[model samples]
Target: MARRRPVRAPEPLRATSMWRVDQVFLTRRGVRVEVTCSMVNDQGGLRNLSVTAPTDDPVQAVRHAARFIAGRGNVSSARQARVRWAREQTTTLQDELIRDRQLEDEFLDEFEETLSAVRDQQR
Candidate 1:
């Protein structure tokens, strides 16, 4: 019997200079924002990555997506990268809301309204 070699993961793109944010917009899916970003893949081909931020704040969502693409980190695969990126963006947004009193108040007001609507539907 011949022994098989284990498959190694593809190396991450080291030069992120080609990466850029294409668009950032709010999705219709209540309080969700979608960020579309593009970059030159390792194969010298153009690739687009779209990630979502589960927040009502469009400004903060855009910033979070831009930072994720600009940050130096390993991106093994699109699925893995997106999951990691979205989690980081959510955490950063939460931290920002905690630090900004006005932003926090606004977010809370919107959240309470959403909750109230849901409760009305259930009752």
Candidate 2:
């Protein structure tokens, strides 16, 4: 009889002051990337910020999500620098998509709708 090794339990999610990539998966439209920012408040309560980005590439999606969250404030200078880097990368990707004519009208409509919804929610 062969002995089986015990399975280790999955690690718990750690809260961080900066946004961290939580999950990435494919969707019918494109790849979806989810990020989370968690921190403990002065009142000992937990605060969390989460956002998802739908894009062709997971890396670009993550950068987009990070840039979005970083705009919300309370981020460190180092994190802000990282966000700037992400913004540049995202811009390059967008240019490439435009140059390649890879962006579909349907995708643009959906993206505009999502962007409007986010803006509405912010207000």
Q: Using TM-score as the measure, which candidate wins? A: 1
> lDDT per prediction?
0.45, 0.41
**Residue 27 in candidate 2, Cα distance off native in Å:** 11
Worst-scoring 10-residue span by lDDT in model 1: 76-85
lDDT per residue for candidate 1 within 60-113, as digits (tens), equals: 654455445444232222211221123335446564333333433333343345
Error of 1 at 1 (Å): 53
Q: Which stretches of candidate 1 lie over 4 Å from their true place?
A: 1-26, 41-44, 72-123
Name the regions of candidate 2 deviating beyond 4 angstroms.
1-30, 41-45, 77-123
Clashes of 2: 0
Q: Largest lDDT belongs to which candidate?
A: 1
Q: Candidate 1's C-alpha lDDT? A: 0.45
